[model samples]
Target: MTQDSRPRSPLAMVLLALLAEEPMHAYRMQRLIKTRRKDDVVNVARSNSVYQAIERLLRDGLIEVREKLAADTGPARIVYALTDDGRAALNRWMDAALATPAREFPEFRAVLAVVAITGPDLVADRLAERAEALAATLDVAEREERTSREWGLPRVLLLEHEHLVAVTRAELTWVRGVVDDLRSGALTWDTEEMLASRPPE
Candidate 1:
């Protein structure tokens, strides 16, 4: 899918990811996403979108903005903290994000579409590549967690990091099986049979 077709904003993900931690300043949040967090390794993509995401979150009331007098900047700065409502929403999103893939049903629809497409081998290859990428992403997160733990991030933060890594790994496992099945002739298409099975439509 094109970038536009992707989630219009990583705002939701960004807010939830930050709220996953305690309150932080905008610059700190930006640094957290963009700057090297651990020994020049493991960085979250810190584009201007991170700023935009925070703005949207403030407008949405997902995160409350507190204006504070700053000592270093010589001006008031806004700090963001997750609201109760935000936390509730975060809980819901986390549950959905971490749950098994089929829970979304799109995976199944994609499976059907893969079978529907010609050159199933190519699809299987793509799926395997996707699985590898997903695993690598999760591994990077694991490394981040390890680094963060050593740096003495809050206990809760470390725990959540562990859970997030586990969820990513679980998704990788699911994708691996999907790749295997696609390559193993576990699914197939029979256009004529499907046409016959269909009703008038």
Candidate 2:
């Protein structure tokens, strides 16, 4: 099938995936995402976002309210289920997310781009500090991976964590080299020279 031209939010996909597994209310879906640590990738931090996502999904015909449950107290809760369109969209999202490299502007990369204003010495020291912290994080990830393996968690399930560890380790190695270059005067440069080298916007 051709990909839908409409935009789909990550939260919407998360909700769709949850609904595909089983019909649930927004609150329950949000809880499952957190309880399962899926929140690490999908941002279900706000209930408002979840509700908003539901509204969008409904409007787009991706999902529908399956039933309304009257609460003992407070308002009634609407249970949602995925439509056939939603299942297709969910599969599309999964395929795109897994196969495509998004053009994401991570904060660290953005900071690194403008960090030259602070001078190489300062940036190098900061990079070294970041590397040390990343090393600690890598140690934790390694331990977690070992424990997960011992617990019989399949490799497919832990691939996301493994990818994170691999990327962080590569970054740490590059940062260490940069620190050495800065300290050894191999990357010395003046602020004015840097400014002059850049074309005016």
Candidate 3:
């Protein structure tokens, strides 16, 4: 088959991986994501999102309906399995994801670019709040990791949680440092001067 040209969204890639394990219905896939904590990386909060990805994969010929089961009380259940192309695509996506970092435009980074407009004092206060939130997230991730280890889950299985904790800790540390600089007047900026320097629309 020709190389798949569809975008490898996180949701789509994850669905493919789950199917790679075994053929399963959409509900099972969604439940597995939540139960396995893959939802932390994949957005399966909405059931419709999973169905939409399935539809796209079907259109691209990446996945096929393996079977449909008759249900006594509801709509028939459709089981999906990965096509050969889907497995190949999944492997390619994993390789690229691991070897290369995609350019991501996070809202926080965008705000930081023009944060001087908000003035250092307000920015410092907001960043302090953000630091607290990050700390709480880190705490949760650390606790989850400990629980997983206690359950005998291997380090490989908890790598993503480790990444989340490390990134959150780093961000919290950086935010606290910036807050200190702002409070000590080390990072002060002139709002009037900044406004005057803006180019014409």
Candidate 4:
């Protein structure tokens, strides 16, 4: 099977995750996702986002859109099914991300990509920017979540912002390590001979 085009957004990930099981239409997906989010006050997901994700996935060749047979509700709907490449990529991304506790983050892998090339100063700068951006977004999300009326929220979820905080700190610590490496001149750019002869993991 061909390797699939990588997906970046959470909605893209969610789409692939769901489509791995079976084909689904936009309407059913919206319903299931709404139920999953436990949002009852207002729709956390929009029809446009769902349709846009579908279009993007189709464009990326991760999903195939099939014309559904006529049903009681409306016009012929498009059912999305995962291609062979989609299945393979979804499994690969999941295995890589969920492998081990500390070794399982996509964000860390992304940082490592830069660290392997640009040394530490740039990595630290980028991490600082990211941390600040994520913090501000999280603050807004928390405030909105609290003031908004939503039904069937998890009892403990109201106080679960700690997870985001912890992850942010972990990333910051990694960034600090990168900065220290740069300051101490510990990063070696000469790695071709090392990698060319390295053994398999």
Candidate 5:
């Protein structure tokens, strides 16, 4: 039973983590995720997805309905709490996620792969713009990291943002170098000519 047939959802893991704190209704769960800035990682924009995740978690027996709350002015809400299984699942999921790097297809990399077709100057210009944007993001991440540290947040809680800053900084460095190479005419490509000259594979 440890490995069910149902597929895992990132949102389900998030719900488990939240319920581990205390039982919460779906609406409160969504609100807390947004307020805590967890929406950055999870797509809380889709309320339907949250509801679907709740249903799946309940079905998996990882979470149990704790109680039903009735309000005089609004609809009744069913609160959910993480089961022991949910806690164990959450820990397992988190450990795996932190230990492994999942293969992800970022849009920027996809665009970068085809940028040579756009020619070097335009690609360089676009890359320069992206570098600026990344630098700005890094600046914000640094400030947030400092604030978190001063607020006595533990390194464990701050590591993800720190990793983001480091990755962005490295990307900026690489991008600047690429832009320089492009502007210096060190990187050149003849798309039409190269295609015409291509041999059958």
Candidate 6:
């Protein structure tokens, strides 16, 4: 595939990885992702998302249809397997992902950059809500990790879950601290004065 046409998104990488294991139909791939709780890391909420990624992979020559099996009660199932190029691409993507941090622009960070416009009270209230949500998410991830261990899953399989829990807990703590600072007037800002101080072009 040409550089411009290379499939490099998280979904594309995941679809290739799934094919690396064994040739499977699109429906089975989607089922496996959900069953393994990979949906948290990959966006497969829409059924069409998986098929769309498959199409891109096929177009890029990263994967090919191995066979089509007729079903007794539905459309034929087309099983896909990874191409040689795909295996190379998967390894390359993994290496780059693990060895470097890509610059990402998360919405929360963007909002924080200009948050002073929202005034202290509103920002504090919203961040407080976000902290609650983060706490709940962290709790769920911790529970899931414990359950996975109890079920005898290997540590390698739970690495992502562990990372997620750690990140969520850290975010929750930071957000709570910011909210406390705002409420206690430790982080106050004069919106009118700041806006008035802006330099004219």
Could you give candidate 1's per-residue lDDT for residues 1-201 as a string of tens digits?
Answer: 222222223456655567568887776776665443321222235566566777777776778875564767566667778987677666665555455332244574577554543455776787788888888889899888888888987876466567678877988888788777877789545655765676684
Let me know the TM-score candidate 1 reaches against the reference structure. 0.51
Q: What pairs collide in candidate 2? A: none
Q: How many backbone clashes does candidate 2 have?
A: 0
Which one wins on lDDT?
6
Q: Put the candidates in lDDT order, highest first.
A: 6, 3, 2, 5, 1, 4
Q: State TM-scores per candidate.
A: 0.51, 0.89, 0.94, 0.45, 0.86, 0.93
- Residue-wise lDDT of candidate 2 within 110-190, one digit each (tens)? 997887666887888888899899999889988888998999988988987898789878988988898999999998778
TM-score of candidate 2 relative to the true fold = 0.89
- Please list the C-alpha lDDT of all candidates, in the order they appear: 0.65, 0.84, 0.88, 0.64, 0.83, 0.89
* Best first by TM-score, ranked: 3, 6, 2, 5, 1, 4
Candidate 6 TM-score over all chains jointly = 0.93
- Regions of candidate 6 where Cα sits further than 4 Å from its true position: 1-7
Kindly list the per-residue Cα lDDT of model 5 for residues 78-179, writing each as its tens digit.
999999998888888777666666557999889977664566777888889999999999999899889999999889877668888899899999999998
Worst 10 residues of 4 by lDDT: 1-10
Candidate with maximal TM-score: 3
Worst 10 residues of 3 by lDDT: 1-10
**In order, what is each prediction's RMSD in angstroms?**
7.7, 2.3, 2.4, 9.4, 2.9, 2.2
Candidate 6 — which pairs collide?
none
Candidate 6 residue lDDT tens string, 45-127: 88799999999889988899999999999899999999998898888887777766766899999999988776999999999
Better of 3 and 6 by TM-score: 3
lDDT of 4 at 132: 73
